[model samples]
Target: MVQNWSVFVSVSSFLLLLLLSKFILRKTRQHKSLPPSPPSYPIIGHLHLIKEPVHRVLQQLSYKYGPIFALQFGSCPILVISSPTAVEECFTKYDIIFANRPHLLFFKHINYNSTTIGSAPYGPHWRNLRGFTTLEIFSPTKLNTFLSIRQEEIRSLVKNLYSYSQQSFAKVEMKSRLSELSFNIIMRMVAGKGYFGAEVEDYEESRVFRRVIGEVFALGGASNPGDFLPPLQ
Candidate 1:
């Protein structure tokens, strides 16, 4: 019993020491100079400064802080560049430094543990994913095979629009119809079926795919508290 207690205490002490070292290292690294930034609140940082029309808000901030400025959005440190020259420099001169993505939980859970191309860190694995996707999924030959599917979707969109227009100058909402057409077309090309709206080939698979897509969109739009607050995660 005494030996077990001693072992537990030793493990706890080691973990505490490791956490302390990590915090100290982070603070030490933060001494590196960053771009000009507005005053930020603790914990939430500059997240509250955001307002409607994100582009306009960014413009306002650029006007105040200069063309290039830093912002803390929750726990994330963002570098905003409004200047075309600066943006060009970042992508050209410093592309490799900025290639890595943050290790977000959404990427881990939704992206098969950051294995997906978009979420994966820049490395051999990411390069392979990109190569595979480009060659197999998005190659011209592959897309050419799906030409009929695209035409079918476009015809469906046109038919739906014409149906609405048959009556005296009816206001036809094309946005939803266009989106539906695009989704159906892509799904049909990829899976040989649709997962959303009409003409879904596999009902059970469509239901699952629809729910997954809905969840993905919702989670993408809604901020995760655990992202900013590590303790919550």
Candidate 2:
């Protein structure tokens, strides 16, 4: 009977503490102006409100909350803008302010500690990288040197399509084919060889490249739990 009474007291104390903390937090936030946010749980925040087909869910939220609203996913605060005018203002007028990439785990590890052009924050390092790519890689003179590579890849794609179509109308998956075509063209230009299609110099190396790149593309766009949840990180 004594143990049961103690357990009840402990539970009551925990609930009281939770309530007090929430009240304090609410009072603290009342001083600042934040965008309209749906009610969120303490730790997980609005994470539980999100579902698959995220774009659709966000659209529905936009209808209820208006063009601009805020969300909390774990410890991270997110600003969702559904207005084209707001998007334009962010990209054009305040581009520099929004240029920094989010510090995600994938960028930390896979992108060589966030130093790559895509992962790096906006600053001198990024400017240097951009300048180098502009002058050395994407310059007209440099692209002209790889003109034959592009032409050859396009011809190969057409020939493959023709051959496949000759034997009745077989459904060609353009998405994968186009992906391979683009990847092969880029790899050939960068490494002096393609990693996809039948023209690969090393089959094993090409297999590894395909697998690693496929995983990168798959994971790059995924909403990782570690990215938002500090405990998970």
Candidate 3:
């Protein structure tokens, strides 16, 4: 019985030493290899610090920490680059590892299963899509073919603004007008029709498209809690 107790005590001591060594090693490696990070709390991590206009917050962090700093958005590790030089290096020198966009809900669900170039993972499928875009979609000839549409959209915008200000001094909001102008141009290029302002090809489709665009923009600006806490999703 005494022998068994001695053996058990010896085993427990060994495990305790092993665990302590692992803990110390982890701390040492983290300090050495990882970039500087802001204070983090258990489970939630640095998520509580994130807010609207994330770019401003990121800039502040860059100023506080460094050009390149680490962040813990819940369990996920984020590396933020604020310096142009570092950004250039990351894309040019270490691009392959960082090529794929995060497979988030917006990219996967809202963006038609991440098939789009901006959302697609970096692989042969992505290469094919990129090749198609380079060779067909954004080719100079294709853009030249859409010159009429672009000009017409611009003309319509000028006409509307003129009409709005024809009589006297009038307050005009350029933001929505410009936004709609952009949408009209893109829709004309893609669907061969303008969905906004004067002679929309399909009223029903335009209304549906307007709603979808509105929702997409709204969701894009809004923060998602599930993004930080994956289990919540």
Candidate 4:
């Protein structure tokens, strides 16, 4: 029993020493290789520096640091490339290195763990999907076929605005009206029917669908921290 205990203790001690050595070596290598960044606070790294509308903050930081700079966000190393020249270089010279997008929490939930074309890895499947989308949905012939529908939709929107403008004490939110018109037009072309029936004017269901589409677009437009900090994602 003593011999077994002694052997177990010896093995555990060896493993502990090996892990410690590896941690120290990794730290040294990281310190030597990575580009310099702003000092980070414990646990959160440089997250405190990120203000509301993160793009603005990043743009400001780019002016102080070089166009291409590294930043730490919660133990993750983030590379920010700001200048047009630096972006061009990344695409032209270092395309392979930069092609892999950081996985984010929202992406995982929305895109089914990166199975979709937008988040899929660079491979044959992605290439195939791109080819199919281009050939089927984005072809010139497909778009041309919908021209008449688009014109009719635009005319309808104009008519609605004209009627509203003529009303007593008229006040209209152009943004909301435009959003509804755009969503209805797109839906009609893609789905083979508008949210409202052809004879129906200003249907409640159409308004609801348009509002939902607007909300979705607004959500998609904003950036999430998980996009920059992949480990947290």
Candidate 5:
């Protein structure tokens, strides 16, 4: 029993040391050609520097770090390219390599693992969707067909606002109303019914969907550490 225990302990220690050595070597190799970035905390990386309204924080960092910098967030490695030249290179010269967006927690949950157009990777699926959108949905012929519908919707919206403006102390939540109007118009065109006027039980569900879509946009608009700290994402 003593001999067996001694062998097990020796093997365990060897494996642990091997793992640690490999991890250090891998990190060194990966970062050898990467851009320079700010110092990060152990384990959490640059999570501490991340703040609400993330774009402002990123803009500040860009000012300090020369636009093209890297950082770690959680276990992810992130690269930020802020300069116009670097941005152009990313989208033009290294377009294919840099086209893939970082997979983040929120996108995974909200986009069904990037099945949607906005989140889908730059591949055949995205190409197909883009083709469909261009050829079928937004083609000149389609737009011409829908012009009357759009004009009627706009007229109704203007009439509603005019009526509201007639009140003694008129007030308008223009943003919310515009969002609803847009949603209704799009839903009508796509489904042959408006969420507001339809007798469907899912009218409320449609509102929920709109709200969730808005939240997703808001979250995406916010700064996220995972974007800068790529490996953490």
Candidate 6:
């Protein structure tokens, strides 16, 4: 009887949460002019409506709600645009309005308080970062100066591949090799030393660099539930 009562209480509490969230959502909607959105639940909102093959699901939603629509994922509101003209206009006319990236937990922790070029908000800092990259880092002269590093890395990769397949045909994991080449080139250019490839001088440093890079890439594109749910945050 006690176990059953506990379960009953839990269910009642969840129902209350749902009802309260629904009331809050309704009140907010009354004040703001949100884009056309499909029916959504209270707390979870359109999260439950999303399925695998995300693009196909989005295409179906577009068919139902038109080229541009809105979706609520927990407390976050998302705008979906499917029309080419709308996309062009967004990037051209209203680029500044939509320039900022969404604030995510991974970015906050891994990105030095979101001050890096990739995670910085759209403002004076972002503009300075853009200008720096354009003129200092990615400029044609800068790229040309790094040409020897790229050439050396590519040659080393070819030599390694040839050595592996010299005796007999060998299957190489191109993905990892390519990733190493890219990292090695970037490290050599930025730090004047390659942490990857045969030229690595310090194994410990290489291991740490590889580990950090792996973590950065792994968390970069991952979605945190805390980002959407304020209570979780």
Q: Which candidate is the best by lDDT?
A: 2
Best by TM-score: 2
Error of 3 at 99 (Å): 2.1
Model 3 lDDT, residue 36, Cα: 91
lDDT of 4 by residue, 1-233 (tens): 99999999999999868866664565468876776567765445688999988899988888888687777675467888888998898899998777675566555776788777887777787789889888876799987888887888788887877887786767778786676566666777777667743444557876786567667567667667666544445
lDDT of 2 by residue, 1-233 (tens): 99999999999999968966875586358526778888887667799999989999999999999999988887677889999999999999999998999889999989999999999999999999999999999999999999999999999999989999997988888998899899988998988899889878899999999999989989897888988876588
Q: lDDT tens digits, residues 46-151, model 5? A: 8898887788999999899887988777666788888888889888999999877767666677788886788888899989989998988899998887777677
Candidate closer to the true structure by lDDT (higher is better), 5 or 6: 6
lDDT of 3 by residue, 1-233 (tens): 99999999999999868866664565457867889988876556688888877889988998899999988776467888888998998889999988988767777678788988888899998999999988786899998988998899999999998998899988999999899999988888788888888668889988998998999988876657677777678
Pairing residues by index, what is the TM-score of model 5?
0.73
Computed on alpha carbons, the lDDT of every model, listed in order, comes to 0.82, 0.89, 0.83, 0.73, 0.76, 0.88
| Model 5 lDDT, full chain set | 0.76
Give one digit per residue, the lDDT tens place, for model 1 in 36-155.
Answer: 888876556688888788899999999999998887766677889999998898799999998999888899888999999989999999999999989987999988888898898888
**Model 5, stretches more than 4 Å misplaced?**
1-23, 167-171, 196-233
Q: Spell out the clash pairs found in candidate 4.
A: none
Identify the runs in model 3 with alpha carbons over 4 angstroms from their true place.
Answer: 1-31, 52-56
Per-candidate TM equals 0.80, 0.87, 0.80, 0.69, 0.73, 0.83
lDDT of 3: 0.83
Residue 190 in candidate 5, Cα distance off native in Å: 1.8
Q: What's the CA RMSD for each of the models?
A: 5.1, 3.9, 7.2, 6.2, 5.0, 4.0
lDDT of 6 by residue, 41-104 (tens): 7678789988887999999999999999999888787999999999999999999888999888
Better of 2 and 3 by TM-score: 2
